[model samples]
Target: MSDFRADTVSGKLTTFMHRARAEGVAEPVRHEAKRLILNQLKASVGATGQQAVRLMLDWAMAEAQGGGGAHVHWFGTSLPPALAAMVNGALYEVLDFHDTYIPCFMHAVSGVLPAVFAEAEAGGHSGTAVVDALAIGLEVELAVATMLMPTGYYRGMVPAGLTGGVGAAAACALLRGLDASQTQHALGLAMCTPAGIYEAAGSHTLAWITGNAARTGLQAAALASRGFTAPPTAFEGDQGMFKTHSDEDRAKIDGILASLGTEWRIFGQTYKVVPTETITHGPVECALAILPRAGGRVVERIDIKVQEIVVTIVDGRRERFGRPSSTPQATFDLCHCVAAAWLRGQFTTAETSAPCYTDAEVIALSDRIKLTADPGRPTFEGCTMTVTFADGSSESHNVDYFLGTPNARVPDSTLIDLLEQYGAGVLPAGRAHAIADAVLTLDTAPDIHGLIRLLNKD
Candidate 1:
């Protein structure tokens, strides 16, 4: 069963799986996985009340009450494994507050957790097993995403849709106890299913893509277990994934496959402080730094100079910058995000709502927001923000790295508090901490029963 041809992407992924399964996870790696898991669950719990999330949950609850399949966490409903992953995956991304792998601009944990947890819970996998699956799955997800990004992102491809299912498939195959060959086939099938377009981010189509990637992963793995076959050269062939999405130099990607499992890509994931796009993080930091001087002032002009790609994606919905109609739209409008935060002297999830997006004062300020992209600026981690008041006084700040990025990491305590804060609002009393505890201690624990199973005992 070990017929690894190093030139093929499937072979490379197979070797990655073999090494991980044989070696298990190191302590630090497992801890990182726990941190990623807790953060994703936090995002899922916080977004449970979103209109889109509620709509999906209402649809899933119909079949989940019977308890013969995987249970959808945060909703107390059970559905088939694939469907469970689909619903949970949508919740993970509907909020856009989850972790983003900065290199690829993808929410690294969103799609993978849904598939990993759904399969783990359905298969009665232990906490250790779940953590292993998550680490491996997220690692692969970020890897493929790295191989496609910058070029793929600029090509109008959604990074999460392109890599989420592939990561999920790798994890699901592990849970289903498939061989490396079967795992590669699952990866190939998963590779064939990435269809999300970057143009649909603020619309409902993003939720569909996120959910479909999660659903496809579980289904792909199940199909692979039944002798399903896929192209072995699906990743780096002449017309493979690499060629289809990106025009990056082939030399940079030539040795990429052999590099798997050496240094995990899971470490590249960035946690968000506010529920806005990652591109807004540094600019928001720059905005907040100068807000004390510019607060309560009538704006003559607001300018943020950032990398060109930031403008392409974060400010992609330029028309909605001053007239956002929904939460999703508000989260993507860099102009609105800074203007509203400038007016309020702070930015929080509240800014991503109707009251903030439609506020007359916020609109007046956002309408003056001018996002200038500097083509020479190539980094995603820095930006310059300038605010000019009607009095002709201007305040400016330059940020090198925002908190929550790899260089400037949000503390683990802050992330734990994020989850606990959700308990006070959305989840049941203490459910948030309970989930946090389960994730934090997962590697040494017995099982994931506390995470996905519904316990009725008083």
Candidate 2:
């Protein structure tokens, strides 16, 4: 056994992650990585004109000190690799429509792909290289999340922000071709910068946290490449990351490292079919299913039973759920999402923002929705919606798996259609289709620069 096996949790993880990055991953892993990258790019394009994305891009560009190395998606400008990663990472998440890992409730693509694309573009890496780095990064991130589960969120930490830096740093290190020790240093540096609180949800600061993770990861890798040192046992000591962020007595380091590269966690990731919270997707689907039976009748009441975790995260704040003033707030409000779906028969970006948010019908229906915790329902993977019509008739639907869950992967044709639907008006004519075609065949592309070029508006 390696010395790291008996040393500490961080040591073992660092060693395992370095080894995993060095080895060749499966073709499916690479394909999934490409899909995740494409998904994030699509989301970035869709959010190109959003106020949050515009503000953050401007802030990132202003902070650039002339060391332009990489491009920001859809912005048509180059910035320092770290700054570019920050801007693009935040853009990937501005719509809240990125790929998520169900187990960790972390948006894996938003956390890792921004840094991977930035570093790959800066170094003139190939498309295959980008996929490889992303796969490795996601593996490291999911492992970290799996080990720290049930506590990270309970402690009010945002999963993406809490674990994103390490994932992004791992991808950066791989793209830079760092060895085990250097990768360890990169992870240690990343651990020092973990941030994002649950309280930041429903605010512009949420996107800022996502961007900070990408920037911090790139900076950590850059520093580590120059022989910067960090404590080896950064995750298991008394004052380590795991101890500080989680209530666990000791890190589940060995268990997390044991399955690295063997069981690909990337395969279990879920893509978002809508621009809303993952937990709300199932409930929205349930409401949509019941919409057809209502026949345009007034909804007298809506009774929703969901897992306790869902209530805690999405419906915990009565005032916010009752009346959402902002897009972010509406996205997290289950009642709002279900109500919108019931009224419109679909929940999209349009429903989460503006006139739709303040629509009288949506507000009236949302107020009638009563959310209750179901102790028997262990996971947010499913929810049941009961709609009581004014005529004293009721309809109920239960959704065990939403469209993009691992058990119910979105069909490629449907996903492509959604890409076009979401990208309409945002991307120039035919631009979205061309980008999708390139991403579908990303492995054959000579370089990622050609792909990045497609993202820029002419």
Candidate 3:
């Protein structure tokens, strides 16, 4: 309601987050916040044993042996909040199972939660406090992302990396109870390094970017609390990021600002039913359905019709876009994902990893796949797939809304089971279940120490 946009992007986002913390998140939205946390925990902790996690953890232990008091989620190593943020953030990304904001293809809650948990744990903040900060943090993150997406994406900017720090900064500042001015400064400082590109997907660098964004937010909030300041025009001036990263549409920026408190961008999010790329969910589900009907036919071709974003990301001109070169790239390759899932008869996290990715049959099927963009479909989640056989017969299946989408939401009971399953991958038995329980009661819980312990405990 206040004049959030009169100053710069920093001031506006700060006002939006600060105002929400003051009024407290609405009950329904707080429940949704809890849902995001549970999903993030499931997604992140499940990836603790990954190569990316090992790399970050080894670095944290070696360099941050005596950094500070913040404990890494799932690893229990004590380090500075910034370093802890890095490891936790990387965990969210390595699996590529986290939720994405459809509008920007940026991770909705992954980057921000690491910052929230780091600040909350280090400062001993309450879970009720976490829900509020997490909600506000995500609100600002999604807000900033909405202003830049599609256009920014068109310009080769990665949304999570570019907008992630701003979201993280907002959450940390709110948890630390920084005043509006300092919060604005934190936002500006957090935007200093927004490095992400489409090419980084398979290099193990994409996950690290998420980690760096979390670290950026934690450091920005910490420095701002002690009087560190960044340029007021960091985002919108002549040589600013708005022009550099996005299409610089003034109306899009202004519209998100106006919709801030009332509209709730966080509510618009859709969680992934499958662990692969978000846009690939509908197609994977469609492919899996079509596979059962194929019976004994030898598949000659696999035709996929997706939304425009899929085509933009996978033009099929490049070999890597059509055929994955590595495990991480395979997660994003539409053809590989569809082929692998159809052959395996399931599209779980296992299908995205080794042996399965390198399997001969999967690669053969992926080569047979072709993608077409459907102009009529407006959203990123739906797709139509047709599988042709050697007998000159074909079958097609269309998916409008797969499970875990906002249109067809995954039930909380199902999500609870999912969290337990993912958490059990690296955790002791019953640990993940306890983690899910803590999240369900998070709104009323006194502090997040118990949840942190559940994640960090041996």
Ranked candidates (lDDT, high to low)? 3, 2, 1
lDDT of 3 by residue, 19-41 (tens): 77778789989988988888887
Candidate 2 or 1, higher TM-score:
2
Q: What is the TM-score of each candidate against the true structure?
A: 0.93, 0.95, 0.95
Off by over 4 Å in 1: 1-7, 62-68, 295-297, 314-316, 320-322, 453-458
lDDT of 1 by residue, 1-458 (tens): 55436557777887788689789888788888999988887676677678887787777767556544676667667788888898888988887888988777778788888998888888888888888888988888877887788788888888888989999999999888898778888999988778788778777678778888998988899999998988888888787888897777767664666577778777877898777878888888888888777657867888888888777665447743436888988888887888888888788778888989989998887878777887767677888888888888899888777888888888778887887665456566766666667678887767787766422111
Better candidate number, 1 or 3, judged by lDDT: 3
Q: Report the lDDT of model 1 for residue 374.
A: 78
TM for candidate 2 is: 0.95
Ranking by TM-score: 2, 3, 1
lDDT of 2 at 54: 85
Cα RMSD (Å) per model? Answer: 2.5, 2.2, 2.4
Q: How far off is residue 36 in model 2, in Å? A: 1.2
| Residue 334 lDDT (model 2) | 77
Candidate 1 has a TM-score of: 0.93
